[model samples]
Target: MQIALTKKLAEAVGVKAAFAQENENPLFSWTANWTKVWDNRRTEDMIVLVNNATRFTVAIYQVKKKDLKNLEVMMKKAISNTLLFMNINPEIVEEYMRLAGDVELVQNRGRQTAAWVSKAGLECSFYVGREYNGIEKMFCDTVGSLINYNHVNITKTRDEGFAPYQEMINALTELTGKPAYKYRAFELSATLNLDVYKAVRRIIVPANLSFERLHNVLQTVFNWKNYHLYDFAIHQGDKYDPAIRVVPNRECLEYDENAVLMEGHTLSEFLPEYKHILYTYDMGDNWEHEIELAQVIEDYDKESPFLVEAIGQTPPEDVGGVGGYVNFREIMLDPRNPEYKEMKEWARFWTPELSDWEKRPRVIRL
Candidate 1:
């Protein structure tokens, strides 16, 4: 795997004067490395800067060199994660990202080993000890997972849905006696209300996830992409208040004056306040998910979010909402129906993976 360090960190590690330039540069040479190459980042994978160190680890990244074309974006994301790990405000992180590499950073006590993000958007842990071999092991283990596969940075698992960067937050916990940021784990039951299909999913998510990401997790649960505008809101006495809605970034949207946006305010604060939230996606189709807070895990230390239960098939995106989907299901139930072939063909356009649309309802437990 290829790793290019900032000139300063390369110096701190004495990598500058180590091997002769004409000789073997094992740090950048995939063949000279002793560790097993689980994935490949043969060219350039990461731009890492770690002034933070603990008895356990040093901050490092494992970028998937092939998936992404832009290393600068990965670099900026790593820097933002580092700055955020140091308890810098989200707004300030954005400013730092805007400034880009012009900003010089220093090591902070907050992050004993700082932050890193792979091109696959994965955070890493480089375990170490006081012994010489321990440091060597850390380097080898960190680099070994750089093969073409996602041995290090995987966002989704078979059951665990959207994995948060909990490792980054808890990197300093053992040394400092607490995580860099406190996250509350929430057990949520999301039921998509349709005219016929009652799709349900039980999820466990960290509250620190932004509204935008929470929307994404819901999208995954329903097998729908974020193709339309969506928002999270609580029910008022008569109507759901737009004033209390949490939408995407204001810069990206023509936002309401009163709607809460991501970053400046994240789900960390708003999610715990209410037991029920209405997640509405596709304003035209108007698909509503009633999210009921089933349980709360205080001082949660789990590595990622997951889906514990799933039931019923979800209609594909833009199926004309409740009424249209009901008609589609009716047609599919009878093979002799004239619209059966045409309707199933159309559903395949939205869900390419499903072998048969006329099959039984979807059910999952994990």
Candidate 2:
């Protein structure tokens, strides 16, 4: 019965059933992790159920509209406990919760109850039923209603419209106290080498895009799987300051140990003025690319990043680097070569689109 209920809950939330866990005790207990997807972010959700011969208790840990200060001190502790149980940092959990208000807890007393409306609109009311199937249906229906309510609310908020570009422009204008030039589009050319035969991609991305997002765009443009370490070297004047390099916070081997993270800094922060930069991917192969800011378009649409043009195929992964790639290409082009057939078979999965250069708009949304 517990397993069936667990399956039902997981299915209703569109999460894998494998995430649900059951514990055999005096009272059967079950817990599961779920996700709530919104326009800008995804939030973690948790559900716990305890049932015995006579009583049942259900708890939901999800984003709510009430602030932490508004919730009782006991409820704050409950929120902390829930975070600890989920192996999430309570501080981070609390911070996000504060932005959305906080996690809500609802409890009711009864053997049989019915659905009702709360101040927050439609809400699930727990009811303990004699038949296990009846309890399962009631729980599923109630939670389903809550999920639908939240989804509708979030969608409504998105539909109401928020102009991020306009907001950014306004903020900059206010800060500078002058009319600021808004760069809607950024034209960038990424080339593995300046030699005759080299892999190159010309992309146009929204100026507000973060460096991390730009990295993803480059990965897609080159048709290379992101399976290696990478960093952006930003030179100031004549010096290469390690502190200014953009690197992944996690697994970053920085010489200065104080390198800035690439997650939050946007392309607009260091482009146009700083036309040339170095992007290196894969520490072992040391595949380096020259990223040059070609032009900043004022009238271009500010939607998302996309590939404007591409040339030359991205070398097969683990093909040793530029020198090895040159050798492999030479052999593959000459079918008479001894290693031709073997190399051809190895390169069978190479993406042809990466080699073709064309003007394509809206290739990717982000």
Candidate 3:
């Protein structure tokens, strides 16, 4: 093992020097899929396991001698920074950080402390385990097993199915003291739609996570693809088959099985063409004319008041975004702006346009 790392270290130094200099000093010595070595006068190989795809196994090295106490502090900072970049939860990161002060330097038997000077110097190795059990395992075994056995419909009856999101929300609320109304529930409901969310929530949250706790977990794990928005993804053919199908809410109202279209179908499969069903929105001529026209409505002194009501309320600091008052001011003050115009278009596209009389100060009832 030591011989292999020595050879790999030579190769790594060669590669590093080639990048910008013919014989520049190597910053660190490492091997791919094996031990990393530190070299000065003597050499020490630090073995590391890199099989966990989601994390990096860091091998620290030094050319000069150092005491264990000083080394521990350096290792702690290095561990904290590395974990932060890997996007591990701050709480989990903190747990690992506490272990930093415990790292000890293995020393030779009968060697005096000062006599134990390292020619190759001090070495530290850390293996960062995967946070969410590697991608393949979670998808294939955990989620796959869920789909294989319970099926999507099971999401409704199973107590485990809907509980995680609630638990996470509850925990975050207790920790942050944020109000229920402060959260962006539309996003949370969207997260509950994914299978991975339930699995991770089980690991992170208490048995009964409140709304705030759920929000924090979502904020932490939003980068994972399983929690990505949209029910159907590019690779849903095998995974989302009815054999393993589950709805977002277990109580989800079913559409006519015959009326519902599956993976490969186009927009025509669901909606009629008269609805001007564009899979994506159009951008074309009179686009500027469309803008000028909206400005006219704003100038007439109509629609602005009710627009205020439709926006609901401002998002809290925890739920930062353009909310009711800000959006209303932006739209009314400059209705012709492209962004506000796009917002208006989306309102019409996603929901029906309210009639002048129908426009209430509060969100219009469905």
Candidate 4:
């Protein structure tokens, strides 16, 4: 969906003929981070994004007609403006923008890979504390569509002396230090609630185990593919209201207040205070697992996580939920069932052993 700049606002932005042209002409030097889009007191015609630190308008798009081509042009303009504002080389930024617009070339390149198009270029390096894929996300959200894998390759070099990015990297490094959490180990039990049936796995994790690590651990134990968003809810009693949400990224922040970032927050920070927690995965599917302390093991000197016990097979991916899985099991068990052949072909996922310490511990990590 394209958000066109109204005639009045475009004039205020000091552009007279940009809308009619096949390109963008910026009369005002847009210094604000267009990615930091906020919707605080929005009108039908306009959207206001605020920069708290500077306390100023970032970008205000006045709505009118919706058109994809116009939006793409706006994005091209925004990308260049932001890069210029960041003190990046205007020529380099222009070149990157041009390359990024080439849909075929970008699609041929990596969607998510370590071997980047350019180093220091396409760097997940910080820009006003931007996280991984920050630029891509901003563009997608603004355009109300997914423009992934078509990201502009920011070729800003380390030689440019990006001090703020360097500082951010240093701070994040400090946060990732081992034994950062206030414990040696934890005895946590995760029980997958499948309505009529409950599949549980008890494991011992390192003190500094992050929500992200725990997410992986649970995925391994339950045989999930880790393809969806997940959140850990630390709540007190029967009600989940006012729960402390620990999520994978900023996208989840919109759903909860004062939510904790999973990367830095660890088990030690909450396990003691809140013995019981909820691990909710696949926001759409809503797979809710109850995670609780099985035994207090603050003194256990375990360097790596270990799965001591388990129950039930890995539920089929997107098998709808308990009802869906039960229906699947019923169909798969009966050889005479009409869908048996098709089900068998589809059900190739590894069904974890009831108790396989030898196999599980090898796969688990700190």
Candidate 5:
């Protein structure tokens, strides 16, 4: 699609080129470690990308033939003026424009894979946020239209700080021709925490969870290193500590305009997509660290369940190494001690058990 568009643009401007290149321009400069894989895909011929520049991505199309300079000139102007490089109809343009945004491209190429000026370069395609593709584009356009028509400034924060999510869901429901009480954003927010936030952002919000609530939540939990709490809270399973309980806030649901009260109320439906975005966003530059933590937990549980169980069974130490003969509690609590190692080895020591007399005494560090 890109190649054909660039080729046509080249012809329109009466310029000929033998080959063309596609480049992707990223909205920002800081690259998240986990997203590196996806970012790398932008380098493919059909999709060239530039990262970390500003708020938008630029897709550049290189013409295959270099001789038609006139076509190149016309195409460059068309792109600069936000004209349709493709011969699609007004209806398609309106739909595409609503979903995506204006077309952006370089007016001219300085050199092969070299930087080009936008004014002189030929434009080939429309510019939208990196997330705006296909279905997402449709949803964004439809919802955005509703927001615009309703006179809701999505960019602004409401008096209650709840208006962002309310506005988004309200707009979405209106576009879908459903009532405002169809979805429950706040209910989903209260129960799901970060994982649900990540999932819902991908599916419903895609952008972020109403900036205000998401900001507060992230500020509190962002850099926390408590791996157990992070996992237990985000991933669904048996509660880590039975005594821990969450205090629910029903304020978001009380209002008619909020997303949580929408017609299709399915927490399950909203979780994964939101999570995908959150994980991708939060892990940004430090994504590797998070992955390592996740992998270690998974591997320990699988490759050596007995050891993991032993670690779990071990009780907390009272006073750091006070008694002689080494307390079982102390050994269990101490990760670096040799006693812990022996316990791990001994737990799996199925062939023969170590006799009490033969068991070595715990070594005391000076």
Candidate 6:
């Protein structure tokens, strides 16, 4: 299959193309600046053609009739890998796919093809067949069209699926305009409960912090081991209208399937609207914290999460949520109790003193 593709691609592009396995990187030096073509056969039985000068790549998947059911999956993997190889963000590719009107490529059949030009001027094409005639020309035409394509207009037209993301980006851009020396920061107090006896930690985090980063800050400030699953649920009014749940990739099944990814979104986007949020950590323990945005510091230039104040010690992780923590706390406070010494030692190890709080703010790197 790969040999045939190599021969056909060579014939169509009028260049000597060779069959290279997925892991193989063949060296080629060309005199022309914008006409270099490279071919590789992926381990998944797909042929990838990359033109370095044009910043264009094509993934050709030769599917058998029996494998038609898995064509969409194959195409997605191929496209994703191609984009990764081309140093393109999958999100941008997703936006392009949405604009191109065939995100899943489910309707693509034998010899069907799709092409998209990225915001960074990279052209990507997907072909579902062995036929290579005119494929090069198709890529060339797509690149030509891309040269004059209005990406912002395309984004506006296909703005339905990505409204929330776009809104978040716009809000962030507005908030962080011009990248001044100081950044807008959020002073948040995350309390385990509203009761007087509950554990509480006051933190000042950058407005651009993502939910994932918030999780890490909570873990560090509270001195809790990151051994459990967690999520953040935003609320409006009495009902939790729209929440951004951030769970470990493996534990996503535990929460609502429609939850937004916790990585891309920044705290600034949601904190301004929904000032109150519920952060649940260790699902089994049911440790819920009420995260309130106490204040927004406009002149703060810190890059990390800073612990301002802490009241009471964070319960030892896996202590079975609030109820278990209460029981454990009771046991630790009583020296006569059988678990007192062991539990106290455990608490001392995980809980940090007020002076021990690192002065450096925690920064979330994407």
Clashes of each: 10, 0, 20, 0, 68, 4
| Best model per TM-score | 1
Model 2 Cα lDDT, one tens digit per residue, 51-98: 222112224434332321232332334434433322222344444335
Q: Which digits, one per residue and each the tens of the lDDT, describe model 1 over residues 274-306?
A: 667888889888988988888887765433356
TM-score-best of 3 and 5: 5
Query: What's the TM for model 5?
Result: 0.21
Native-structure RMSD, model 5: 21.4
TM-score of 6: 0.46
TM-score of 4: 0.49
TM-score each candidate. Answer: 0.54, 0.51, 0.18, 0.49, 0.21, 0.46
- Model 1 Cα shift for residue 52 (angstroms): 16
Arrange candidates by TM-score, descending.
Answer: 1, 2, 4, 6, 5, 3
Please state every model's RMSD to the true fold in angstroms. 13.2, 16.0, 24.4, 15.1, 21.4, 16.0
lDDT tens digits, residues 200-230, model 3? Answer: 1111122122322233333322222122211
Q: What C-alpha lDDT do the candidate models reach, one value each?
A: 0.49, 0.49, 0.25, 0.50, 0.25, 0.49
Residue-wise C-alpha lDDT for candidate 6, range 1-366, written one tens digit per residue: 121122332333344444333331111100111121224432132334322112233343333234434433444444444433222333444453443243211111112111221222222222222224323322211122212112233434565233222332233234334222255778998888623276787888778766766787788776677787777788764425645555546458555677776756778888778878888888798787888889988877443366777777677777777777778767866789998888877766543223444443443221
What global local distance difference test value does model 4 have?
Answer: 0.50
Cα deviation of 118, candidate 3, in Å: 18
